[model samples]
Target: MWAELKKGAAVAVWFMFLTLPIMVVKVNPIEQTVVWRWANLVWLGAAVFVLTVVGRYCSRHRTELSAFWPDAHPLLAHPQLKRFLLIVLALLATLFPLFFSSYQINIMTTALMYAVLGLGLNIVVGLAGLLDLGYVAFYAVGAYSYALLNYHFGLGFWAALPIGGLLAAIFGVLLGFPVLRLRGDYLAIVTLGFGEIIRLILENWNDFSFGPSGIAGIPRPGLFGLTLSVDDAIMYIYYLVLLLGLITIFVVNRLRDSRIGRAWIALREDEIACQAMGIDKTKTKLTAFALGASWAGMVGVLFAAKTTFVNPASFTFLESAIILSIVVLGGMGSTVGVVIGALVFILLPEYLRAFADYRMLLFGAIMVGVMVFRPQGIIGNPRRRSYPLPMAAADQEVGHE
Candidate 1:
């Protein structure tokens, strides 16, 4: 029975994919009729109906389905299967734009960038156990850096990208210096203030940032002076964001498995113990701050390039909260979990188009539900089998500086 349902879902997924294009194009029932727009909604309803039936059937035969699609089962936990499925999913995502509209590709591009951002925050909050509420400040810094460099100095998007990252890193270090003395709630407050300060500066500093109006007409990324604007350049941007997402994941995973990762874990679990074991807390914490900031910076640069216009409005305390929420909802210290969280937080809202007015209400309710029922997150950290990412060595001798 389980096997039958597992096979059914697999079949249903493929069926949906094959039928979607046809349904979207040919199923214009209301066009000749009176209500074309309503007819399109009807078609959407049909698609949902089919998907619901597939879900119900799959749920009914769980036991046999678990045996066949073992990767879907908790007991059949296999890393190899997980990796295989992830690879397949990545390939599908990479090719999705080929069949999707440019509009859809743009949405996916946003999702991918946030995935990278979430991955970066995962390092600080998940691995390093730092509670940073001002992460978006780094993102804002990166975006503004790119905009300023490109607009003021006549630099291209490609040239501005890394420079933006470097500037964010510098600010991260600068911010880390003063806040290192605080911890837990105090640290969170300071970071929160830090983010607000950046926003205020951008808002008031009309001489540089143009205040509330923000900097516009920023150049888009290009390849060898070839801009992506005229054609389906959105698809090209999607690929670029996808590549950055993949790199963020790869680099994070590698970091998690190394000695640096171990030190971070040590610091996260117990800073005092880590110190007793000759670990340098200051250095470890600073590294976490720096790396996390750098990640945000890179995303910020891409975001500015992608949007072609940015200002203080885009990077707010609420934005920081959402990004941090993705880290929490996805399960801290879990890369794939964060990605999943990013998708849910970033893309799920779009799916709720009908409930536009109640979107925030529903989001708040879901967040409360998650906190109450599964605070550990959907993909909670496994008990064992940690990654082997490297880290810089902690000072062996007594070194507070």
Candidate 2:
């Protein structure tokens, strides 16, 4: 205990010194003045010390804790209780917009959009085991598809939605073909490069993409050609995103239980074993990429419609990192976890505007803590299927034994 306390104190002191220039000292370059906020240093040291000690304790007792709890929640294991909780959550979601302001609804709508993106990426990174750092390139494809179609041909949001997804899927397939043999770091680098290439094209090609100025005054999604007021539009979009999120959940759940999904998982576990087991690696990879990209593309179209604008800057590498973080921070293969992760990540930052300067610092700290303590993620374990042998087969095996 003494050694642990001493180590924690050392870590805290180290962190305080490392962050002194930024957290404790503020410089006014214009006036050539320096302001020292010593209190921040104290708070930082205290926080780091507590977190280090707590983290070490948890690490040491993790096995014992796991043995005691066994399940994440005992009540959650009961079907009836699970059903009731789901119903209650559904009610709350349905009534959310009625109780909150448009700003809140808008923020939730963005969260739902990210939830869809996380689920889509989950297909590739979580299921297929592909490390795609350029996932945002497909997102940009979808956004640009709608913006350009609408700009050049007066195409509406409804018409461009599917088209954007299709275009993004094509881009996904194109990307998949080149990296078919690549794996691990090589694949990540290629995907990252692909993303940068798309962004650079959009940035430099003014005649094609309107350059950095972007396309604006894009129309919002319509409801059977009926016009809506600003508030009504916000509410409408919220509902639309809610519906889309539901559909995505259903589809991803089904896919996770399907043959293709199993194949993807097998591939993720071992490519050689997957191929040896008669799974076609090429087709499996292409489908994973295509399907994942399609979802991103569709969400991109919605993003364009919701904001009424599209630009290259909006689909940067940071966006890809955020989406990837959502998948990782949530249980990668768990649909419900991804949705929860998106809500926490998107909404928490919005509410923490007052601590904007410390937001990234806090985010990094939380990520490190989670990685060290619960690498499996918030909802780590996904459901697995069991196959039971027939009585005759069991008897035959027993007799042979």
Best candidate, lDDT-wise? 2
User: Could you tell me which 10 consecutive residues in candidate 2 have the lowest summed lDDT?
Assistant: 380-389
Instruction: Encode model 2's per-residue lDDT on 72-105: one tens digit a residue.
Output: 5667879999999999988988899999999999
Q: Which stretches of candidate 1 lie above 4 Å from their native place?
A: 1-76, 383-401
Instruction: Please state every model's RMSD to the true fold in angstroms.
Output: 12.4, 6.0
- lDDT (0 to 1) per candidate: 0.81, 0.88
Candidate 1 lDDT, 180-294, residue by residue in tens = 8787889889989999999999999999999999988877788876645534678888888999888899999999888888899888877889999998888888888888999
The TM-score, computed over Cα atoms with residue i paired to residue i, of candidate 1 is 0.76
In model 2, what is the error at residue 167, expressed in angstroms? Answer: 0.8
In model 2, residue pairs whose N, Cα or C atoms come closer than 3 Å (at least 3 residues apart or on different chains), thus clashing, are none
TM-scores for all candidates: the values are: 0.76, 0.89
Task: Give the per-residue Cα lDDT of candidate 2 at 156.
Answer: 95
lDDT of 2: 0.88
